[model samples]
Target: MNALYHCISKYHSIPSGAWDALCKTLTKVEIPRNSFLVKEGMVCNNLYFLEKGCLRGYYNLDGKEVTYWFGFEDNFVTSFYSFISRKPSVENIQALEDSALWSISFEALNQLFDAHKDLERLVRIINEQYYIRLEERFMAMQFKTARERYEQLIENSPHILHRISLGQTASYLGISQETLSRIRSQG
Candidate 1:
């Protein structure tokens, strides 16, 4: 609940009444580690606000898990394309640790946004932030050297190295585990 308030407050000025109303509509749930929140080929019905622990979004590429991104506490996780289009998703969202999350179904979220213009604005800002992060990641993969990427990852999320498994970290960096190990050793 505090996480939602913090996010909304950070993105837009929300009236107290609207904030309370939105909070009332949210459903809080605890998910076990390694459980799928959104599986490939399923429509992503909920927008999750992570309050504790971590989650990852990944896709299968040539029988290998290629991680796209990770979401930690106070972050939002969703299959944006599938959620917005109301179609089946190609990526899978899994809890990396036992997590506490507040979520709302697509229908409920739409109703809230319709009822509160500020909420809609907040959603737009969040989407923009997501897009910017995605663009940065794309550029890093395209233009940055492997060591540079690893350094940037460490700089941006120092805890990731300790929190996530080496294999998962390698996948997220678009590198093989052996290469990641070499990068780590050379540093």
Candidate 2:
């Protein structure tokens, strides 16, 4: 809960009453390794704050899963497009380890947001942060080599190498396992 509080406060301040109300909507969950929080073609109605463990978000392309993002403790993960559009998600978010999460449904969150303008502003700021991250990722992919991307990812999330398989790490970096191994050796 403190993690969530800090994450929100990083962007904007919320009234104490609104924060308390938002906390009431959250439900803590334990998810086992290899389980999906959201599967392809299913609507992602909940947003999750990962309190412990790791998760990966991937797209299924021609029967192969291509990893794009990873989430660890103190981070949030959701199929944002699916949640916002009320449509089936195209990607899968799965637990990479046994995980602890606090989740709130879209309906619950929207209701809270409606009742608290300050909370809505906080959420807007949060969305802007995510958008900025997306843009940075796009720019990195456009201009950075695979090794450079790997280095940047490590600099950003140093624990990732310990939490993921070489294949998963390689996929996330859009490189092969051999390439990742080579990069790892060099680093």
The best candidate by lDDT is: 1
Number of backbone-clashing residue pairs for each candidate, in the order shown: 0, 0
Per-residue alpha-carbon lDDT of candidate 2 for residues 1-187, written as tens digits (9 for 90 to 100) = 7888887787888889998998999999999999999999999999898998899999988887899889888787899999999999999999999999999999999999889999889778878888898899889888999989998988998788888898988988888999988988996
TM-score for each of the candidates: 0.97, 0.95
Q: Look at candidate 1 and tell me the lDDT of residue 78.
A: 93
Cα lDDT computed for each candidate against the true fold: 0.91, 0.90
Residue pair clashes in candidate 1? none
lDDT of 2 at 123: 72
The Cα error of candidate 2 at residue 121, in Å, is 1.1
Error of 1 at 148 (Å): 0.8
What is candidate 1's TM-score against the reference?
A: 0.97
